[model samples]
Target chain A: MISLNLVLFISSLMFFIGVAGVLIRRNLLIILMSIELMLNAANLNLIAFARQSGTVDGQAFALLVMGFAAAEVAVGLALAVALYRRKDTVQADDINLLNG
Target chain B: MNALFTSIGHNLFLVFGLLACAGAAVMILSTSAVHSVLGFLFSMIMVAACFLCLSAEFLGMAQLLVYAGGIVVLFLFVVMLVELTKYKEKSLFTTQIKWSFPLVLIALGIFAYTMKSNLFDAATPVALSLSSGLAEGLSVSAQNAQMVSRGLFAGFLLPLEILSVILLVALVGALVLAKSERVS
Candidate 1:
């Protein structure tokens, strides 16, 4: 049998990868993608546990997460575009307009 | 015989896991915004395949359609519209990579030790509540989907409704944010 631990390990690994991405990448878009990776890692954990516990609740939540992620991408990209329009740049460090 | 089956399943899981990890690494490390989006696509598809392995067929399909289809296209459009290609070479990564990588390694090490200790030892034989609802004529995916919807409409109705409102707000917020201010 495929142990749930292995699945959880993979999820944990992916989560850290996302953390690294968010910390290391300068691009706002890639940071958003990393955030998606982290969310996906969490969803993987939820689905894995749901399967183990014999419940459909986790699956439903995962579906909701997908919806939430889609909405997030829509708004996030729009903001990125607007920021680029204002600043002529998408580099996270350069967009310091809000730094007071 | 059971050993053979278990080995096959284990290998399949490893395959998808490796694909996801590799894609995530590529997404994180790539310089160009378009390349990162492509990497994100690969990672999302691999993650969806992992969901399929977990028997979350409905979620897997939704991940493919919503993520790979919708979110990726949005990212692509913004990447193209912003023309992030020009800034790719100037600032691909932050100065924090040197420290962040080591910190991540420590965190992963801690997680692996916890896993080895079996802190999540909930290995009781799963007694499924929805198994009785499965009909003979329906496929497994169909049965899973039915159970998911049943749960969604019953136990998760409020959250589903809330999600619709959230999507609506996001739509309007995107419009307002992206719209240029008209000067008199």
Candidate 2:
């Protein structure tokens, strides 16, 4: 069996990479993908701890997270499509309409 | 032969976990949107494999089916739909790259420190005993799907129903948002 600490370490690395991607990337789609990466990293932690503590709640919550991810992607991609249609660009830096 | 297989089994988490991390890195660093989606697909699959390593068979399959099969295809369609060629020559990263890197490093440093402090180690035994009592028939030896189903239905039924409603709302919202305005 893998140690919980090691799994936690891997998840943290993935989460931070996702954070970096969100902060550094200019494209909206990639940012959405980075969010997915972060969610997956959290799911990994949930499953790891679930296994460590011998319960099914973590897996159930992970399923909920997956459902949430799907919904988020659907809405996010739609927004991206809408943005591209109106602005002719998907770059995050370009969408400054709300800036006041 | 038995020892070799056991060793491989023992190290499965390490192998798939690292592969997942590498895939996330690739997704973040890749220049093309298509490449980024592919990298995300790879990372999702590896994470699913890690779930399998942890014996969560149902969650692993869900990850593969939903994330790899559904989400990546959606991303690919959007990538193809949007005009990516014009932006190809432009820089992929934003101006925040300089500061973001250091901030992320600091966040990771805090995470490492917390781990090194062994906060979870002390809580593990208590969690284990409590869960073992709460999980009457949902033992590790039970079928993964069965255990998960029982847990969801028995404990998480309300959330499951609420999630369905949320999915419905998202579907409607997506349709509304992506719909092209009809010419008057």
Pick the lDDT winner.
2
Judged by DockQ, which candidate is best?
1
| Backbone clash count, each prediction separately | 0, 0
Error of 2 at B21 (Å): 0.8
Report lDDT (Cα) of residue B79, candidate 2: 96
Q: Tell me what fraction of the real C-alpha contacts between chains A and B each candidate also makes.
A: 0.78, 0.77
lDDT of each: 0.85, 0.88
Question: Which portions of model 1 miss their true places by more than 4 Å?
Answer: A98-100, B1-10, B120-127, B131-142, B182-184
Per-residue accuracy of model 2 over B1-184 as CA lDDT, tens digit each: 9999898777988889899989999999998888889899999999999988888889999999998889999999999999889998889899978899999999999999988887456344212222454457554464778778777887899999999999999999999999999999
TM-score of every prediction relative to native: 0.90, 0.92
Candidate 1 C-alpha error for residue B34, in Å: 1.3
Query: Taking the tens digit of each residue's C-alpha lDDT, what string does model 1 give over B1-184?
Result: 9999887777787689889999999999876677889999999999999988887888889889889988888888887788865774585788887898899999889988878887467585363345444433444445777778877776789999999999999999999999987888
Report model 1's chain A TM-score: 0.96
